[model samples]
Target chain A: MIIVKIGGNILDNPERLQAFLLDFAQMPGPKVLVHGGGKIASALGQKLGITPKMVEGRRITDAETLDLVTMVYGGLVNKNVVAKLQALGCNAIGLTGADANIIPAQKRPVREIDYGFAGDVAGPESINADALEFMLEAGLTPVFAPLTHDTKGSMLNTNADTIASVLATALAHKYKVQLVYSFEKKGVLQDAADDASVIPYITAGKYKLLKETGVVNAGMVPKLDNAFAALQQGVAQVLICEGEALPSINTRQYSGTTLSLN
Target chain B: MIIVKIGGNILDNPERLQAFLLDFAQMPGPKVLVHGGGKIASALGQKLGITPKMVEGRRITDAETLDLVTMVYGGLVNKNVVAKLQALGCNAIGLTGADANIIPAQKRPVREIDYGFAGDVAGPESINADALEFMLEAGLTPVFAPLTHDTKGSMLNTNADTIASVLATALAHKYKVQLVYSFEKKGVLQDAADDASVIPYITAGKYKLLKETGVVNAGMVPKLDNAFAALQQGVAQVLICEGEALPSINTRQYSGTTLSLN
Candidate 1:
């Protein structure tokens, strides 16, 4: 089984999405797709007078920002992706985290700096794999939007990469699946400024060194943390790679950094 | 503070929603509004191959059923209400329960008799009362569709009346809010078959008796439950009445019955 995380960047191009869907429609096994939508959401926010702000790379979701994002993420972006997938003749089911309690969450407590409406994931209950299997069994690809559950039963914003990693970890342990974080970047850069010098592989030892050296800055920090968390939990392998240009999956010497237990 | 739960029955008529807004706008008090979309949602569902199933009186919301409902609730119905509300100069914010963790919830475990994608209220987090207050403070009406949060971090389907009642319970202690359940019925009938004969009033004690004897049957059961729950939870009063045919907030002799703690 394979789980692919589609970056928000890729969403900008209709051509690329169609390309991705064409490739995806023919891919083997039950594939679960996850997506992000920061770019478009931000644009909508600009129009709505809700200036988008970020805390640690996540949208600082206030009431106004919340409405804007939901409209973008749940409405415009979700439907667009679903339409593309459907056009490619793939039996794809598009859903937000709230559908069927897909992701139970607890409201994040007001911290020193109050972040309004941020949701925390419930660690105790996991995604109902049976329904997922049922969809897969019926030849349907599940395209998930990132929104999660917190104990307060509120819909909270979730990073798609993190959601992908968690789902990968869950599905990997259950069915031995490979999880790929597909983004615009060819791979996780050893230095953020230099995209060419990609880290060929990430290991626990190497990951720690990078973190300790503060090389894993900003957005990459959370993405990697979630990657490592997935590894720690049960995922077999997770890859962070360029989604837009990749012509093949797991092609040796193709591109993208591979993060694994090894 | 009155928590008026309006039915979307009249929402079909733009003039009706506008009239309600005008009537509500003139009312001089702190109040909150909740509403539903039985007609629009069901019609949309039928077109989408999702039959709106009513086991007893509640709509059965399965996966397909829910997808259709979401499209209607979050997209058409929500925006429809918002548009009309906005035109009426109400600073109306249309929301799906998923946004800002508005209404926290617990996913009803799938039973042998499934409620489908339905959810019940959980968590003590009230509406972003301040945000609503800001709007209400500025003379904007907050119109909520019947979606609720499934504490599992996703939006869940909720009956509109229950949503209205829940909001009333949550906000009633702070204001002189009335939990209003507006429906097709003229009022709570002393005799179920006699639509014309609206029960003038019911004491909390009498409500319990009527409820137990099946006078409060089917849809009435949940509505009564929410009504009773609201009273028990400290809501000032509960009004079960005709949402579509009501004369105005100015006149008290509207079609629906009024129930109170007595």
Candidate 2:
């Protein structure tokens, strides 16, 4: 099973998203698409007079922000993707973790910096695998928004990357799960400034050296960490590629980084 | 099987909706919920500087309005309902017609009045019965937003009452269906001024006479029409009640006007 995740950058571009979804629909297999909230939420928030609050560059999902994400992520972005996919002959059902109690979570507790209504999933065990398996087995692709429920009557903002990884890890028990993180960039670059300097493959040993040498830093660090964690947790493979590279990835003509434990 | 619909008034009031949902969750058996867009969409549209265009007392669902409703109804209202239902121990899955391709519709054809983005269901046959039955049999209650999709790749605004009716009519082939329209009022009233004037039961014969006498006018006319239409289309029973009366209705105490063909 292919469990692909696309970030906000792709979602912010309509043409890019449509092109990506068309490729996703044509991919021959049972798949799940998890999407991130793009600039739409912040844009809508601005119109509503709700300025986003951030701490150390991380978004603080306050009550208003939670509502904003729920509408933009869960509603506008998710439904639009489902509709487009359906048109492409892929049966896609949009979902948030709260739906069918698919992913139960707890509100991020107060620490040095309170994240407000943010949620953290426990692990693969916390996911409702049966619900997902049912959809996939029924020939339906589940498209998820970046939202989970606290099981206490509140919706919580969740990281789309973590959602994708946990889903892959959880479903690995039943299917050969390939987790792909598709973003704006082609792949993890050896030189961040050069788009053509793509690192095609990275073993755990290589990843460690790259991290130690400060070759991969910033957002890519946490993303690769999540990818490696999924590998350790039973996922068959993990890929990081551009949204446009999905067709090539599906055809085995890999154009991006494939992570593995060596 | 029970198919219940709630309008925007109850949705606009949090406490009232919570109480109503608690009652709904406590009710036994397989059920589905269809919800309408309350003032929230228009309110949000106002914030976004998109003024609503209405003709002949009907809101014109232009592109902006469609986006607005998708965000509010599909996103804000629908997901909130699902999360709250989960908190109440009900396994609720939120959906639009676009999700799982359950409800496919055509964009309203332009004639005298072009109701932009509005969709009309092609009767009971157009509904995806198997998909809904699978969810219901799996013990998941579906909560639908007032939206449908054209198979050609666009989400369209639909009426909540129509959605509820079509679902009831379609599912009647598999299960004995009870269609309910729950709003702020107690039931279809004989006297619009008095809450106690709820007509306990209305057969087709009575409905015709009431219409002739102009006893039930305005919105209730179309509601009763839909109710009767649902009854004609294979639904076993229909009820119009207050949102809080679900438990009572479930228990057969009947605190609303039950409709029948007679």
Candidate 3:
């Protein structure tokens, strides 16, 4: 099974997203899609007189923002993807972690900062893998929005990357899962300015050396950390690639950064 | 099997919705919930400067309104209900018609009036009864939003009442289906303003006499018509009642207007 995560960049582009969904529909075997909110929420927020509040470059998921993301991520984006996938002959189901109590999380605790309604997944062990497995075995593709629920009746904002990573790690026990983090770039680039400077492969040792040399861009750091974490937690394969390059991943001729344990 | 549909009156009130959900959760056996968008969409639209357009009291679902309903109905209302139901120990899965291609529809054609993205279900036979039965037998309760999708990849604004009726009529073939249309009122009333004048039972003959005598409210005509349509299409029972009275129906002590073929 493959768990693929796409960020706002791909979601905001119609042609690219349609192209990605076509490739995704064609990919053999069972798969799950996790998507980010993109600019739609923020843009809609501004129109509704709710200016977004960001702290340390991370969004504060206040009551209004939680509703905003739930509408955009859970409703608009998720449904659109499912509809498009259905058009491509894939039986897709849109979901939030709350749907089947699939991915229960704790409301992020307040420390130096209050992230408001943001959620933190306890670990891979917390996921309802059985329900997910049932859907997969039923020939359904699950398209998840980046939202989870607390047991106490609240929908919490969650990170899309974390959702994809956690799902991959949890489902690893049942199937050999390949986790893909797809974005606009072709792969993890050695240089920030050049798209052609793609790193073909990175092991733990190589990543450490790249970090020491300061070759990895700041934006790619968190994604790489998540990739490495998912790999450590037993996910069979991890790839950082362009959205259009999804089909190649299935063919094992992927032109992206493939991460593995060393 | 029971298919209960609740409208905006119950949905807009937090206390009423919670109380109704509690009653609904305690009702034994397989059940499905269908909900309507309340004032949230209109309020949100007002904030975003998208003044709603209506013709003959029916809101025109332009592209913007379609997106608005998708957000409010499918996202805000549906997920909150699912989360709340989950908190109450009901394994609720929130869905729109597009999710599993469970309720496919066509865009309303332009006649004298173009309803824009409005959807009309092609009767009960068009519903995916097998998929719905699968969910019900899996111990999952499906909470649906008043939205359907065209096969060509567009989500259409659907009437919650129609969705509920269609579902009940379709599932009646496999189960002893009881269709319930729940709202703020207790039941069909003898007088428009009297709460105590609840009509306990009505048949096709009784409905015609009530219509001729002007005893039935004009607003309730469509609902009664849908109810009768469902019964004609093979639904075992049809009830129009207060959302709070859900549990009473399970025990055969319902204080609602029960409809039947005479």
Candidate 4:
């Protein structure tokens, strides 16, 4: 089974999302949805006078910002996605971290550096894999909003990437399924400027060297880290590439960046 | 055991972080860390003429912003925290999501609404909790940056709060620990205008009520969300209170907001 996660951007693009989801539902083992709605949330936040702050690409949620996120990520975005899936003839369940206890988080210690009302993953322990599997078995896709719970019954923010990696690894561990990291890019470029020159594969030793030499820069740094990490552990294989280009990842096939322990 | 996550603002006030780490190291529990550094990241981004885009509180990391985050969250901030921990009588290791396979993630799909270069939690796989537990066993504290991994060998932006929640839950599940959501004010204010009105306990039903009719307001939304998530699953209890109080989450003491399942 290949576990597929569509980004919030994809979800935002109705045409693309509908097309992608339609294709995804037709030929899939278990498809779990992880998404973003930063645009919607931030737009609303700014309109509401909450100064939006961010580090890198992740938003720094303050108390006000967090409220905007819930309305968008949990309320607007989550329900709309579920509705779309239902319209597509797919049985989709909309989940906020609160439902069935999916994502549990910890409150970050306060500091002069206020990230506003943001939170982190204390544990994705609440991910009901059994429920997810059941959805898949029953031909239903679970469209998950990045809303998780903490022990105290509060919902928290989550990174779609972290959740996807967790589910992919967890599901892979549970069943030897392949984890696919789909995006708009072709794959990890040998040279970022040259997207066509994909770095088909890299060994752990080389990965370290690449970092040491500084060829690995910016966001690419962490992506490679997780890719290598998955290989070190046991996750069958991980494929990173543009979603529009292919249906599935097979080492033999001509497509995205593939990472494997082999 | 309790996992104390110092915020990036603590970095702004080195002396404060140093002081907190001194006590945190001495406090009891199997601990892991998750932190943020938006204040520093944004300052540099502005100097570089990058008008850091935020969707909600999250940043949309493009190539340039990513570099800035690496420097702030991964380099200076991470190192500074480590240095402080060392001085505070704690054996602390500084890490980004790239190291030790902690927090693997993936790029969000390109939403029609651009969160700039921002990312959200997709999956939270591959945290080396064994190493964390090993550190806790040896009384070593792990100082973490909020950076996470994409399926590629790239670094994706992750919110600190999300990071803390994930780490708290992960460590708690593995080693059995308590979590504290300390801030600068009274914990979980029943009324935002009145910080002293801390709610010692909350439930799912109560949380919904809080969200309605304006009690849950803005910032506390995600904070409360993540807190509830952790409590629902593995965390023994989650306390939301003032960070300056330090090492004490007692609800009766008016230290911070203490959340319970009851």
Candidate 5:
């Protein structure tokens, strides 16, 4: 099974999204797609005169921002992806954590910075892996939004990368899962400005050296952490690639970075 | 099985919706809830500077209106309802027609006025009864949004009443189905101005007389049409009642107008 997480860069670009989804629809075997919110929500929030609160490049989801993200991520982007996949002959279903109690989480506790309405996955046990396996076995491809519910009455903004990693790890026992993170870039780059500087493969040692040298910085840290976590938690392989290169990954023809524990 | 359709008036009122949902939550049996879009979509559309086009009190959905409704109805309202149901201990899943390809529809053809993104149900065949039955058997209550999708990648604005009716009729083969339409009114009233004028029972003949006497006026015509159609299509019973009286209907203790072919 393949679990693909598409970032906002691809989602915000229509041509890129269309090309990527077309590839995704044509891919064989059971698969799931997790997507993040694009600029649409923040733009809409601005229109509503809601200023977003950010701490250390992470969004602090207030009540109003939660509603906005739910509307845009769960509603607009998720449905559109499902509809397009359906048109391309993929039987797709859109889901949030609350749906069918698929991935229930607890609201984040107030720490140094209170991230209001944000959620943290309790663990792999928090996921309804059996339900997901049922859907997959039944030939249903799930497209997930970056939202989860507390099993109480609240929807929370969650990180899509975290969702993908957790789902991959949870489902690994049942299927040989390949977790892929697809974005605009070809792969992790040694030089940010050079598209051809894509590092083809990285082991734990290489990753550490790259991080120490500051070649891998900022947003890439948490993403790589999630990838490595999935690998350690029984996921077969993890790939970081451009959205268009996703279908080629399984065939060993993709130009992307592959991560391994050793 | 009981299939309840909640109208916009009750949904727009949080206190009323909570009361109705509480009763619905406590009800016994396998059930489904279908909800219509409230004023939220229209209000949001206005905020986005998109004017709605309505002909003869029916929304004429264009592309922009379709997006707005999809976000508000399929996203915000559906998730909120599912989250609340989860809190109340009812395992609920939210769905659009595109989800799991559960309800596939065709775009409404252009007639006198083009209903751009509006959809018409082809019939019971458009419903995936087996999927619904599977979910219900698995102890999941489905909450449907007022949207359906063309298998060819377009989400259409569908009527919630029609969705409920079609679902009840399709699932009738597997379960003893009761279809309930819950709105602001206690029941179908003989006098529109009098809250106490709810007609207790209406056979086909009584409905005709009510219609001829102008007691049943414009907005209700389609609702009753759907209810009667459900009965004709093998649904066991149909009721029109206040949203709060939903739980009492199955116990033969409700104060709603019951419809029969007699």
Candidate 6:
């Protein structure tokens, strides 16, 4: 099974999203798509006079922001992607974690920041792999929104990358899961300014050195951490690639940077 | 299998919706809940500077209105209900017609007034009874939003009553299907002003007489038409009741008006 996590930037761009979804639709075998919220939610939030608060690149998900993200991610973006996939002859079903209680989460504990409606998945056990496998076995592709439920009449804003990683790790026991993070860039770059300075392969040691040298900083750190965490948890492989390059990755083509434990 | 369609007014009321959901959760059997969009969409649309157009009680779903309803019905209301049902210990999954391609519809043809983005289900054939039965067999209660897809790419605004009637009629072959419509009123009342004037039972002939005498007029004509249509299409039973009276429906106790084809 292939678990693809598309970045918010791609979703914000219609042309890029269409291209990525086309590649995704043409890919053979069972696959799942997890998408993040884009500017739409923030824009709508602004319209509603709910200015978003961000601390160290992480969103402070207040109750209003949670509702906005739920409407945008779970409703607008998720349904649109499913509809497009259906048009492309892929049997895609849109889902929030609440849909089937597929991924029950707990509200984030208030230590420093009071993330009002943010959630954290306990572990792979939080995922309902059996139900997901049933859908896959029955030839259905699930398109997931970045939202989960507390299983207690509340919805929470969850990270799409975390959702994808946990799902891949959970399904790894049943299927040879390949986790892919698709973003705007071709791959993780060795130099911040040079797009062509794509790192072909990154081992754990090299990743540590890159971070030490300040080569990998900011948002990419958490994303890479998620990727490596998934790899550590029995996921067969992890790839950081551009959205359009997804189809070629399975064919042993060096389309993007591959993560390794070595 | 029992299919319940809850009206918008009841959905708009939290106490009534909670009471209805508790009753629905306690009902002992495989069942489905189909919900209509409340006034939230129109109110939001107004805030967004989009005025809703209605012709003879039917919403004229323009492009903007379709998006608004999709978000309100498919996202906000559906997820809320699912979460509440989960809290009540009912394993409920929310769905739009696009999910699993359960109900494929065609865009409404241009008639006297072009109903933009509105859809009409061809018949029972449009419903994917096998997929629905699969979910039911797996011990999941489906909560349907008032949305369907054109099977090409576009999502359409569909009537919740029609969706419920069609679903019940289609699944009748596999299960003893009972259709219920729960609204603010107790049932079809003989006098619109008196809440106690609810007619306990109405046959086809009596319904015609009641309509001729103007007891049932305006919005209710279509609702009764849908009920009679479902009854004629092999649904075992059809009931028009108050939302809170849902649980007692299966027992010998009559809480609301029952519709009969005789």
lDDT, ranked from best to worst: 2, 3, 5, 6, 1, 4
Q: Sort by DockQ, best first: what order?
A: 2, 5, 3, 6, 1, 4
True contacts kept of 6: 0.63
TM-score winner among the candidates? 2
Q: Interface root-mean-square deviation for each candidate?
A: 13.8, 0.6, 0.7, 18.4, 0.8, 1.0
| Regions of candidate 3 where Cα sits further than 4 Å from its true position | none
Put down candidate 5 lDDT per residue, A1-262, tens digits, no spaces. 8999997899999998889899999889999999999898989889877899999776799998998898999898899899989999999999999898898999999888889999899978779998899889889999999999988899999999999999999999999999999867899999999999999999988998999999998879989988887888899999999888877896768899999888
Candidate 3 lDDT at A188 equals 88
The residue ranges of model 5 lying beyond 4 angstroms of the native Cα positions read none
What is the alpha-carbon lDDT for the whole of candidate 2? 0.93
lDDT of 3 by residue, A1-262 (tens): 9999998889998998889899998888999999998899989988887888888887798999999998988898888888899889889999999998999999999997899999999999999999899889988899999999997899999999999999999999999999999978899898878999899999989998898889986777888898899999999999999988888885668798899988
lDDT digits (tens) for residues B187-238 of candidate 5: 9998899988999889889888888999999889988978888888889899
Predicted candidate 4 versus true structure: per-residue lDDT over A180-226, tens digit per residue: 66666688777778878887776677767768887678777876676
Error of 6 at A101 (Å): 0.7
Find the candidate with the highest DockQ and give its number.
2
TM-score of chain A of each: 0.89, 0.98, 0.97, 0.85, 0.96, 0.96
Selected candidate, larger DockQ, 1 vs 2: 2
Give the TM-score of chain B in candidate 6: 0.95
Candidate 6, residue B38: the lDDT equals 85
Report the lDDT tens digits of candidate 6 across residue range A63-114.
7787778777888788888888988888898998887789999999988778
Scanning candidate 3 chain A in windows of ten residues, the lowest lDDT window is A245-254
DockQ scores for all predicted structures: 0.03, 0.92, 0.82, 0.02, 0.84, 0.76
- Worst 10 contiguous positions by lDDT, candidate 5 chain B: B244-253
**Residues B1-262 of candidate 4: C-alpha lDDT, one tens digit per residue:** 7766656556567667666666676765556556677476676556557786666665567776765675456644554455445444454555545443445555677766554334455433345455456545655466667766553435567777777777777776665656766576666777777876877777768888889978777877988888788777677777666566665554355566566667
User: What docking class should model 6 receive?
Assistant: medium
- Tell me the lDDT of candidate 4: 0.61
**Superposed Cα deviation of residue A9, candidate 2 (Å):** 2.4
